[model samples]
Target: MNGIEEEDPIVFEISVVVPRRNLKLENEGFDCVEVLVNEFRNVGFFVDRVLGLHDEFIKLAAPLETLGVVAARLHMKKTTHIGVDLPFEWEEIEAFMRQPDGSLFSWCERFQCYRHLIHFFLIEKNSDVTLKFDGIEIQWEPGEALLQRLELEGIVKQVFPLHDETKRNKLLRSWALNWWDLISQPIDEIYVYYGTKIAVYFAFLGMYTRWMIFPAAFGLILHFVDFGSLKLLVFPAFFISIVLWAVLFFQFWKRKNSALSARWHLNFSVGTSHGYKLSGREWNCLQAPVELVKGSGIDKTKEKEDLQRYEWFGYLRRFRNDVIVILSIICLQLPFELDYAHLYEVIESDIMKFGLTAVYLLVIQYFTKIGGVRSLFYAVIYWWVFYHALLHRNLMILRQVLIQRLIFYEKQEKARGRFDWKDTICYQGGEKST
Candidate 1:
């Protein structure tokens, strides 16, 4: 090859001025300029020039210096064409250049010209400058000849209106409506679920403890005391318990299904319209006819009113009813279990047992109201006393043994663990490194 072709490399330079106040708020110190520069580089712009200014100059004169120093340092090692401009009066220029920290001026040998009148000069230019600010156009030739003519205009003018009172008020109203919708809707739905579940469970347990446990225990004690063949009562007692449990279970199941369906409708209505697709479990659980009611078409105000009505009737009132029924049964069975001969004698004598019953009921009620594990212990104790009087044999003990077996069997099956040699190899690096 007689001649090898060589092409001039493309050189690009950009300058950005940041106000000193803005820099102080952002960086807190001059040393943080490097961090700012790296952030700009990450956005793909190659900064080949920088200029730093004193705080007073940026506030009262040009604010370009705050951003300039950061820009130059970023390109300092990569290109010889990199430069920085410092704003100094002509009188101080020589003395400032001579300072030990003033080595930044050595790069200024490439300065094209100085334009003093406009407070801006062309230190170096590989190309012309073109910029637009607030609809005003700016163009500079590829030299410093007209640099002094470019006016040092004050802060840029606004092209758009600063305040739109109508828009602001509309945004605030919309935000308030959305926030109310979020709080009221979700809370109502959660309360409905909890209330229905608790009510059903309480009702079932009450019937079981009252009709089955209390009667059977008392019948057993009578057989032992009288030495008569009263074992025949055991079959009738068992039959009644089963019947009570079945009826209660059916009622609980019905209410539980209704509550679950309502919850599904609530979830589907709120989430689907907002572009969220339900997960597989959510989709399966909420796939009910009630959810087909379009949430978008439903008025939130009307829905809220309807939900409040349902919450009062279907949840709060129903739960209170169930609580009253359960506690009434518990109170009625306590004396039968305690074998209070005086109370039994009063009932047998045709005198009302109300006074003694009420007094003992209040005592039991007070003890039950004490919270925590203590309350649970007292409940179990009452259950035992009632069931023993009704059945003679310890039904509570039998029930507890059955429950423990079921729970422990499941736990034992799930407790099996797996070991893999691959896991040991994967973590082997930890042993070596340490």
Candidate 2:
């Protein structure tokens, strides 16, 4: 209890749901639940079972030592500035260092370690072992993981990560619910709690929002303040200023992203990060690397071919998905867009135009819904559409709509591209992981 209390920061909860009736067995040689609990305990997980009405819950937590051992074996990349990643030598544990914040690993890394250990626990083939849970004989196969088998058999209902209440409350008070600090966020604390992906996302969002103020102010001045006959000069000046601001903003953002990655100890350029991911997958209960090598021997040529095949397969899949999306837009959305544009041009009545515009907005929203998206793209589009229809009354309103739509689409495209770039390391080889 003392050890568990001390390691609350890194503790994760895993819920195992079993039917209330099946939770207890009368004439059981070896109960499935008991065996499962024993296996988890054997692998260094702290397990606690709680009885409920319909299903029982088993919560799990890992000690710091267990996490360190797995992390060492996985060869997770450490910050080059701090230290290189090396195999965990338990005897020489003192030589290993904690992160700058004094924590050994981030929440994200710890969870991965937990997943690997649970998913990869091997079963020795001794006999035809069947565990009875209320007369249900669930078959346990030799040379396979018990958890995976149970999961497939519907015995283990679901395995998902749980939040630490203590840490979550701390974040809620200091970060989420705190409005006193609008621009600044506790980024390191966020990274520690939520992991790299979420923390990086917030960091990017904060920077982007802050950078937008300059353009927002410039646009306000252009709209409200009159330059009279110097309108041409003002337009060009505003345009150039915006372009420069965008260029500089992105440049600074790149620097910021790189610094964050280095600080977080993640390598972006090389396959080390990629290797780390693949290693995590490989370390799963599917099979050991040694076993794989022994079973097939080293096939460097085949491995090369396989890598190339996977790479090409990924490209083809992406290209195909893009084509489908493009075709869909051309076939479904383009016609509506064209029809709306033509109607807006020919129709004279501002009232009819307003009604038509509102209908068009609804149609676009319908299309977005059909596509199963309520994304930033549609949100921005909706804002612009409503702004033009309600507030903007001018001779060049239609032209403005077209221009704004084009600009919005371009911005959406760039945003998506940036998102993909950021996500590449995390999700590039997603198919292979599972």
Candidate 3:
């Protein structure tokens, strides 16, 4: 254990150790987190399980050096006993680094952060086993040594206690600026880490607008509404103004957020000082999903691509669902074929067109409940792409690009350490080596 004077501000550096490939904490999930907690309460003396998880996380963290949080995160992932939201005791923590300022923190922050963690625990009452903020209280045999509840299940199913960086940073920056006494606190590192994330998101958003939406949109708009016939498209200026309106708001916020971070002596443009230096493999979580999907490396030793790929099982499942949906749509259409064909006239009329669209939307929603949803939607999307007057082939190309990128987005979430249930990555030798 380490000791230190608590005079200066405490700088808690955010940990970056996620699961190797986002392995699941629980293999099978219940309907909800509450249900899971209730199940635990049903069993007797489950708080011991949380303690056990804490012990295991400590043991795992000792060897991983800076990966204490990551190790704790992984432990919570495999078992629902405890969470990484708790503070690390210095006597127990071996070694860890705060990457933002390149400062090492250990041995003393445990006690220093205790006051901040004062409100972490809560006590409440329930039917089966009452686990409240004050602590755990439950029914037990008369011979027990303590009054603590052995289980916590009736009303509460589960809990995922996670520290929210956005909220924390928001409060910290506000307080640090407002209070002079809090200047010595270690809020900068955490602020910098989360600040960098916001910065990157905005940076990416700016690029996406510049490249993905604007270029093609303005080019098409100008082509459709030429100088000779500007009235061809309804409210051409209105469309242009809509795009500019969003641009102005985004620019204004970007400046405001940057300025707020600057007041706290944080950099809004870059990731934590250490984050900028991390290797590509360790920091893959920061990259764009499309970039991850497009990159691949296959050699004599490896038959498959190095980056994450989609699973055929998921694709087949979606296909089957889509198939069912299309079949249901067909069955519904059999009864309304005459009515739908006749609605072509209503679609052309200005006033009746809205009613026709509303009816179609209602019908689509009704049939969407029946089956073949993905396929049916895909077909509808393709129909629009093909039927559009301008950019006929361009829409098809955009559709394919979107479809391919979205498929990876939907399935490769676990690879990026997302909380995705259906898809998860198998451990790729991230276990302890020694």
Candidate 4:
């Protein structure tokens, strides 16, 4: 039976590693490893154990039924031809189906489901269930998670996803090594294997490369070809054409993006706001507004006030951080830059100037990271400041979204248990028809 089992294809994707240990008998006490394996099995996972010289590996595979149930619970959004999102329903599996590759879930999606299940869903059932792991006695508290406890105690080393060797080799040959056709790419296969992000990135890269060909050809014509009297007019025309090409390329890229989203059955607008809720992994800390309002003895007016307070506080905090960054740059970096410029101008020998420039560059790279202002080094400071500004701006946006969601929850409280198209479609960031 063991030999036959070993012959089966390695379908399990997740593996858990722990120090090598012997299995305990039921007569003695509950072995930690055995209990964990049983817990996985109870949760509808196919668990297999392999022993190594230094560690024991616990391999796990989720059945289709388990994946479906988890997906529904997470309220995962799937693609529709109409370019809208619908929450996953296990009872009606055919409605929220995957793409033509016949993969029920992308590698990214499956990993998320597995992670949530193991980390949050698997809870300790019994009280005072003391377990032993490799000669160390551990307390298994009631209602506490076994895996999390094991992790805390340093019993479990690490958990990571394993790749299917067959699919990996095939992808390597078809996509990575096939250089004969530069434009042709296995986009669908890439999407199926790597999920949407990687596929979309490569799609854009390929499209950009293809678009550059026309400009390249045009530039060659302008460079080599001689047009004696028309040369002055040709320069302006070439400049205008280049600008027009860039504008058109960006506009067309959006169209291509939309087309890909529709083809992949992705709900672009809906998924963008709720991107954090992949299989109940992120955004778990923030409960639904409805749930918060429904809690006993809750005061709605006070809650809104608290949310408003938090929102302003977050903005102020970000402002303070930004002010500190600016002050530091002005106080520390500006003087050094000025000194470098003064020295460069005063220095006469070419070799001395070159050496000074090199030293200045190294000093700038080390201290400011952002090079300088109103010179060749000016771009670095601008880029550095822009990055910080953009980061804070995104945080502010997220804060505003959260506050809006809370307000929407308060508004919905007045609707009195009514469910309509408007309510159904509205999500965490709040939605409007227009």
RMSD of each: 29.8, 15.3, 22.6, 18.2
Instruction: Assess candidate 4 and give its lDDT.
Output: 0.67
Task: Give one digit per residue, the lDDT tens place, for model 4 in 234-313.
Answer: 76456545655664687788999998877777653433445223222332234553344355344667667645765786
Which has the higher lDDT value, candidate number 3 or candidate number 4?
A: 4
Q: 1-434 in candidate 2: lDDT tens per residue?
A: 22222454546566667666645676444787788888999999988888888877878888888886887787665443337755555445555555545677777777778888888887776766888777678877777888888788777887877777887898899898999988998888888887888999999999999999999999999999999977745775565456456546767888999999777776543323333123223433344444544455546776556456657867999999988866654444444544565566667887777666666666566555544556623544543454345544664884657564565556657988998898996686785686
User: Residue 70 CA error for candidate 1 (Å)?
Assistant: 69
CA shift of 320, model 2, Å: 9.5
| TM-score result, candidate 1 | 0.18
Candidate maximizing lDDT: 2
lDDT tens digits, residue span 191-229, model 1:
222333453455445444555655567657765665445
After superposition, candidate 3 runs with Cα above 4 Å error = 1-98, 101-206, 209-226, 229-434
Count clashing residue pairs per candidate. 12, 1, 31, 1
| Candidate 1 regions with alpha-carbon error over 4 angstroms | 1-294, 314-318, 321-333, 336-434
Tens-digit lDDT track of model 3 for 334-363: 333334333433245644544444454455
Query: Weakest 10 consecutive residues, lDDT, candidate 4?
Result: 1-10
lDDT of each: 0.37, 0.69, 0.37, 0.67
lDDT of 1: 0.37
lDDT of 1 at 274: 33
Error of 1 at 4 (Å): 80
> Of 1 and 4, which scores higher on lDDT?
4
Sorted on lDDT, highest at the top, how do the candidates line up? 2, 4, 1, 3
> Runs in model 4 with CA error above 4 Å?
1-10, 22-29, 79-85, 123-126, 268-434
Misplaced by over 4 Å in model 2 are 1-10, 27-29, 79-82, 268-434
